[model samples]
Target: MSQRIVDHPVLGSLAARNQLRFTFNGTPYSAYEGETIAAALLASGVRTLRVHEEKGTPRGIYCNIGHCYECRVNVDGVPTVRACMTLVQDGMQVTAGTVLPTPLKKGGHSQ
Candidate 1:
């Protein structure tokens, strides 16, 4: 853990891990099942979580408790998920959509 949080005050307690592996942008990392996705990312030194609809607007964990959608990310191709409220899973591929390599697709891309 880098900018770590072994235990949090409001998210309740956590169980000891038997050790599991997952990746964020192809980099392997670990976290417990009950730990929030945002918490895990932050613990592992992830600051910027995703970009907003407006280009260049940086967003992260504005509210650690999940009220704000700033921590939104696309999990397994599904978009607009609140990471602060989602728990981590073993072998889960957590890709940080904090910034897009391409601009927003207007009117959706036609096949």
Candidate 2:
């Protein structure tokens, strides 16, 4: 399942640029510089970004914009980050689903 836009009718073949290395669910994948996290995942054929916390239903990129929270992911231990809005950074560690770092309480203790 190739997700990259090989040859567009109007734009032709997209030129490859500087590649960035990132990990998704513990697996390493390459992405171009300036590409969003969601775009990188889509290019790598990762259809599902996460599962619903309560219902456990699969969730992907519904809205490419930041309006919908379906593309939420745990990035570098940060929870609930919108992947569609975040750019892919080199050596970034992105995890799917609800495996997030525990939030801190008012007293600086893990909740």
User: Which one is best on lDDT?
Assistant: 2
Model 1 bad stretches (over 4 Å)? 7-15, 98-111
Clashes of each: 1, 0
In the range 41-103, model 2's lDDT, one tens digit per residue, is 999889899988755789999989999899999999998999999999999999997633333
Worst 10 residues of 2 by lDDT: 99-108
lDDT of 1 by residue, 1-111 (tens): 566555668754454555556777677877776777888888888887776665767688987787878888877667777889988778877665654444346744455
lDDT for 73 in candidate 2 is 94
- The TM-score, computed over Cα atoms with residue i paired to residue i, of candidate 1 is 0.71
lDDT of 1 at 5: 55
| Candidates' C-alpha lDDT | 0.73, 0.86
